[model samples]
Target: MKTIAGILFIVLGILTAYQSKQAQPAAIDYAKERVQILQLIDTESKAFWDKDYEKWASCWAQEPYIRTMGWWKAGGVTVVKGWEERGPRTKQHMEQHPKPNPQNVRRENINIRILQDAAWVTFDQYGKDNGEPVMDMPGLSRETRFLEKHKGKWKIVYVGWLLEGEGN
Candidate 1:
């Protein structure tokens, strides 16, 4: 009876180890999702500075219900309800503002947290604007963005910017 009990214990131990090994793939999948989200953020930044409106738009969800909100150092909160609302405004804004030359944009101190199909991201962005650090301008800004997965792709769902010390 004692020998039989000992064999049962060993079998249980092996089963436990196998279960733990099965758990690892979830972690690996989460890490891969995090990396993909980070890459999407990088792509968004690149598209913005590159003046590629199409690419910039691609970073956002194409759904009719998908909305975007942005707060700037100078401008207060601006909300775009849907693509119809965002499209013309974005186009006009891009047309008005000149694309950064030499693409001196920087993304720093990025943190991403994944929660199931959603992710929250925060980052510091700084770069040279006319030979001066953009951070030195009116406001040093830290940005937070919310992303959601749709059709196996992560898209920016919301954007919030917090500004400190004003400049221009």
Candidate 2:
């Protein structure tokens, strides 16, 4: 009788554990996360076109903590571990290369994916840079960005771009 009671208690514990696991919520809802990330992208794009650095900076994770990387076809890759290091450099560069014709900018074939607290997006971008159509210069380029949810916001942590076509 004692052995049978012990076995029953063990089985009950196992069943309870399984039931609790089943009741736990999923870590991510892809659809919801996708929408949030898309909104973030739109806001960031608008900020860039408007030359709103403060708003643009808000879309990125705070630096000195987040691992970050920026890549360009010409420069290859620049690894900046913290936002503290990247933010000022980015601001200075943009200040020098003002976006005179942001309306002509285009982002095509945008795709986004979310995995838990992380997300990534890829797209083909082409536009006027330095007052000339990029298509006339470097042409269309592919861009990929990695983002993470921080402080209830999705912030970009890494961005990479590759100039399309050969000899670029």
Candidate 3:
């Protein structure tokens, strides 16, 4: 009798542990999605530096909210359906700019944080403005981005660029 009871308890413990682990798919998915968002940002940085506005912007969701560096100009996500929404704007922006992009910049050392319905990301970006290599940005002009999962896809809702000791 004692041996049977011990075996039952052990089996129950194992089952509980297995159930908990199996229930973590959402968490794992959230983490993966967060990484993909950051990767998109990285790709966009390349697009800007390389003068590929379309490619740079392509990383965003259909209608993504963007907070470019300086000047708080807000943009809407017109690419709601699919490629049709993006192809035109991307082509136009690239045509107007015409290669040899001004940014030609690179982002360094990025970190991301995932929350229930939002996320925070920080990275170092250095580039040139009008043929002058812009430098000396300390190491913490981090940008925090707010993200929301829409229809099973993550999109940026808001973003703010700031440094330590700045705001709340």
Candidate 4:
């Protein structure tokens, strides 16, 4: 009876560990992969600053959405929806600023809660613009994005950003 009970306990333990593996990958590997995803995002934001639409759009997966407090609201669509109007609006914003600092770079600190074939990401960005750190309603802008894995590659499906403490 003792032998039987001991064997059962070992089997159950092994099975439990194996079962948990299906939903979560190793933490170290997941963190590294998420860091890579953020680097891709950094490249994308730089393209936006340059107004390089092709490169900017390439940063996202095939179909992506950008929704922010001032950028869009209520079912906004596409990477470049109404871009004709957006260009001038962007120019106006740029006019308010001097040349950005060469060392300035946009950064996103992403904390991934789950990153298997599918992932949930929470992120916040920090940086200086034109030699001054951005100070909006929130100390730093925050965003949450969702990515899906297909054919072993992760693709971002959704992106939402806003200032914390500021209602929108």
Worst-scoring 10-residue span by lDDT in model 2:
129-138
Alpha carbon lDDT of each predicted model: 0.71, 0.70, 0.53, 0.53
The residue ranges of model 4 lying beyond 4 angstroms of the native Cα positions read 1-28, 64-109, 129-139, 164-168
- Tens-digit lDDT track of model 2 for 68-158: 4544455566576777876786576557656633544467898988876789999887744443322121447677888988876789877
TM-score of each: 0.66, 0.67, 0.47, 0.48
C-alpha positional error of residue 19 in candidate 1 after TM-score superposition, expressed in Å: 20
The TM-score between candidate 3 and the true structure equals 0.47
1-168 in candidate 4: lDDT tens per residue? 999999999999999998998767645476677776766566656655554556555554553242323232332322433334444444554455434333344345657764556676777655443433332222355767666665666655565665433232
Off by over 4 Å in 3: 1-25, 29-31, 62-94, 102-109, 129-142, 162-168
Worst 10 residues of 3 by lDDT: 70-79
lDDT by residue for model 1 (1-168), tens: 999999999999999999999876444377788789888987887776666789889998766666666565555666778777766676666677655434544567888888766899998766443432331223355778889888878998776766553442
Error of 1 at 112 (Å): 1.6
Q: How many residue pairs clash in each candidate?
A: 3, 1, 2, 0
Q: Which of 1 and 4 is the better model by lDDT?
A: 1
lDDT of 3 by residue, 14-130 (tens): 999999998775544655866677766666556655667656555555553443332211232222233445446556666766655544445567677776555667765553335
lDDT of 2: 0.70
